[model samples]
Target: MSKVSASRAFRRRVSLCLLSSAASLGLSAPALAQEATALPDIDIDSTAGRDSAPATAERIDRSDLRARQTGSSDTAKLLQSVPGVSGYSAGGFSTLPAIRGLEAQRLGITVDGVTIASACPNDMNPPLSYTDPQTISSIGVITGVSPMSLGGDSIGGIIAVETAPPQFAQTGETLLTGEASAFYRSNGDGFGGALSLIVASDTLSLTYNGSYTQAENFEGGGPLGIVRSSEFAKTDHSLNLAAQTDIGLFELKGGYHFSPYEGFPNQYMDMTSNKSWFVNGHYAGAFDWGDLDVRGHYRKTDHEMNFLDDKGGTADGGMPMNTQVRQAGYDVKADILLGEAGTLRIGNEFQHQWLNDYWPPVAGSMMMGPNPYINVNGAKRDRLGTFIEWEKSWESGVTLIAGVRNDQVWMNTGDVAPYGTGMMQMADMMAAAAFNAADHRRHDSNWSGSALLRYDLSDMVTVELGYARKTRSPNIYERYTWGRGSMSSRMIGWFGDGNGYVGNLDLKPEKADTLSAALTLRDGGEEGWSFKVAPYHTRVTDYIDVVKLQDFTDMMGMPTGFVQLQFANQDAEIYGVDASGSVPLWSDERFGKGRLSAKASWLRGRNESDGAPLYHQMPLSGTVSLEHKLDGFETRIDLTWAADKNRVDPTRNEPRTAGYALLDAQIAYSWKNYRFTLAAENLFDKAYSAPLGGMSLGDYNATGVLRPVPGRGRSINAGFGVKF
Candidate 1:
């Protein structure tokens, strides 16, 4: 019982359990008559009017994510201003989001609903890098229609991050709350801080949160200066516990994360050390055969990479790699209430993962003449899912939703014989005889479905129509990378996209079929004006490319003339459109209030058996803003644009960016719980680049070519917060 007497005996048993639950709900001890409410109401509502009214996901809260977390802590750059999202940067904050055109493992990120995997095989730890945006309190994006209980691998969509729940009090009061924040930035001199705490009664509640960040190398904007190894540092923490009786609500959560470094000058290795841990348990209730939920989770990670002035150097040759992952999952659902206009849901889920990658072996360099190799050993993957959903609402105003899901995935690996001796035992005996002649194990049985429809056509307008069928599977370096020459598949080049990959032992899994439509117009309670427009189309089937294998070998197999790839299977097509709106160009009552916003996106992908194009696709973008507010202060100014991609991809020669426009600004202030913010970001300091950003790795810069990687210059950020 040390550690400050176990935190003063756990705060005196949480102040005697909030004074015995406020004396069994009878009340007394007025602490401002306890009032602190908000949080906890999670039934995974990926916004957009959840059960339809025309919206379909797009939510970001926590005060606009704390004014974009004061200049980047990269949660995909705070979701690149939403609308079809876009981001890629690879440094100064692990960017990489992309939506309409998909991205990384095809998207399906979650937190507060688990699902994480990214021990860098070039992903450099995604999954929103384990929640941070100062512990996100909400974020939901669902790009190209997804809904079948929101989980079924992916087809480019679904991102949800939540935190900040558990806050009870009332019923004879007893509450204590907290919040604190700080931030700074000026082109990478960066800084950070965050915290939160809570304690309640009405049957217990507790919470804690934390954050920290750091930065350095980042000066770009105008001629691409600094930008060397981008620089980063991070930390996070979480804890929660809750309970409420009368047959319902219960929770338990835990989290921890750390990053000792996170540079990535466009990747080729850099992220020396990342650690993670998680835990979960939840239950929500109102039984008697209606509304019930149950959840479970577990996670573990330990990643590491090198080559940033190598800690012990060994730039991939002397060997230095590491990765470890373990995951577990569970979920259950119920929501029946089929009478007054329908509602139904049913669920089941399970997940498991395990991975290990190693390289270990240094002692005298010259490419480990001593042993230690494993590059992905004992890998495994498993999944099981089920879903059923229904929703109704009519009286002519119409609304209909439907769902269906089924999954059963499995993958395996083990029997990788590579233990060191000379040239790492002859390169692990030719990569264990090319992984014992391929096919270690595989299985799949997927099926997904979705349907949505809404209509209202009046009272302010609405309309929506949707369709979906998505599926994905094929990770672990895209089917267990087992090397077959040329730096042995360049370790699957993890999306830094400069190319180099290999893995395809009878691969197959990606299946898609989408169709969407939306149109909305508001005025009722959203005040002034609003608008939306959507359009989508998709068609895929076995799309997982890398192609270009016209001969290229190395690692004791001859021809190192370069140009080789693998990971085949194609046949794709994509289409897109996303639009946003806002109006109200003036307001009074002491002069303050103005608005005018806009957003846009347009995407296209192809290769429908060889029409080409498709590989980091994403072109034609937009953003426009001009805002103002009064009393509590607020301001905004924006502009963002992109275009000029010139449809590339010719077997991965990709490249072709050009087109730019930036300019940003922000200002904010609040009085009551104290708040402040200021931002600037790329205001005229433009040197531009980023067509899916990804290139420019070691050497040549300062305009000496080796392009891509530019953007980020002209910074200025500030933040502050307080609450109690």
Candidate 2:
């Protein structure tokens, strides 16, 4: 077939797939729906909540987003601009976002309204990693005291990401539009590009997006040259279809992702292969009584892990590990107008997950031969949640919002087995037996609620206070991993600390009670000066930490290196404060305008049960930037700094990192339908270690000792984009 014919055929197939998937999910078009209107430019990512609550969201503007895209490809890195948010570095593309000191499963992260779970043992394919930066429309973060409308399951807060929404052309008109962009960075010889296309009519629209990114090992400053096992390559594709009617809008999206190889510098293995496919559907409508929204999604993943060349792989593939995940969920919400001054929101959500993890045997290997090692076989976790929220505003400048939620979680797992019956496998055999003999099914009923109040003291000042009770159940890896052998335990940690971990089925759900307050002083307007400060404190019962299980000795009969640990429940406390401000420097018709912005945060976490410091807490950090804009050109300079990490977790043996600061600069110009960008990062080439980088297994393998991962050196970046 001709190229044009082939392209048409592919588009038809994708459209059919979207329709069929939506139909299979029992989605129906509304009878009274009206023609879809043009999507607004308002923030698209944040779920609805009281505007005056301490959970007020912060958004990354389009211009700032464009600048950040020129420097990196990781989607989670986009949240770094939000105060009290940090990142846990894993692979080149998988950086887990951390709010305050809580990370991983503690933060609710969603893409276009669908939540995707990590499928690998090392967490190399986190939810944000599935979306490419070039396609993102906006990113928003709610730091504390989140509302029940955002769903239940997280304690820290919510991080919402959204891609461009469906667009419809004017009445009786047709539209065809697209954009192409690419970027290159000097430090890692990294390069990537993205392509987006959309076809729309008055009532129907179709869109396609594709991206590819790859990078080599990046060099650290000074003596830290060519940090090994930090390379990766990835490709993603997505198709979306939308229909607008008199009463509502319906959308269906389908996507695929693949990564041939992605190195993990901090873990014991690298992701050799990863493939995932997903489908999602959404509906929004206006009714006589209220507004309604519905969403549903399903995803499946196949992942594999083993040693790569940088990690000294053996001829026999060095302990191959495999994992598979299947996840499905649905959410329904409705807004009912109580009166002219109040609104009531009610929602229901459900999620079901199935997982399997096993290691294949290697022929001619004494310890890993004869049978497969079943790590977490046929594990299942399901949750059903319901919530009701009310918001009311009084004429006296007082606003009150309150909500309550309940979740019923159920978990179960099938029997497991060891690698073989050899003497080397005795520990695994015993542990497996004990796990199988115990009750494999468990259930948890958790409740959460929050209340917020906002009062306007004057036109230039506002005060907001809130309190919340949140609960989270342990994940599959935290409760079902039954391996007790050293090597087996070493294969099951997501913290990237190079330490071994074993799971405990008797773990209890964590409940956190939190209090937060925010004070704002603003002049009210796009360019007006504004300053805000927020402080929050949380106390958690039955927090999942770890306890030492066993220790290993070196050649000299001395205790050294990583040790085995087991998950346990404990009490914990976390507190933090965030401050941010922005001011206009000058505005001129001929010379353009200038602005200055600053944000900073301080955090502390402690295990109240044992009086020990928590692991992976971010030190005092902040960023200051100056920006200038001309007719069609923009320039920006930023300084980012962090304080020394003196508080350490003795149990986990967390490392300490010295404080360091870095400078970055960028310039961009737009003409017609084209944009060009240039940027420089780490301008001084100063060597420093990232506090959240974890222990570098690559360094340990090379020097026979573990060390903190080094930060990337200075880099020059360039990019360009064209729209039609």
Which candidate number maximizes TM-score? Answer: 2
Tens-place lDDT digits, model 2, residues 427-513: 999999999999989999999998888898878888889899999999899999988887888898888898889999999999999
* C-alpha positional error of residue 35 in candidate 2 after TM-score superposition, expressed in Å: 16
How does each model score on lDDT? 0.74, 0.83
Q: Estimate each model's TM-score.
A: 0.32, 0.93
Residue 669's lDDT within candidate 1 is: 85
Candidate 1 residue 387 C-alpha distance from true site, Å: 5.6
lDDT of 1 at 72: 76
* lDDT of candidate 1 at residue 613, scale 0 to 100: 88
* Predicted candidate 1 versus true structure: per-residue lDDT over 1-724, tens digit per residue: 4332343344334434433432332222233234876644646434342646236578788878886787777877788788888866675556768788877578887777677876667777788876678668888887757668777877777777878778888878888876667677888777766667788888889888877676767776797776666776767888889888888888988878877667676655677678988889988887665778788998898887766542223334434578888888888878788788687888888988898887676676544435566767868888899989888888788888788888999988876545453453564467677777776899889888888788887778888888888888888778887654445455467565555676776889889888888787889455588888898988888888767865555568785334557887788988988999898888897889888989988989998887888877878888898988999999899998898889978676667888888888989888766677888888889987778766666433223346666667898888776665
Quality of model 1 by C-alpha lDDT: 0.74
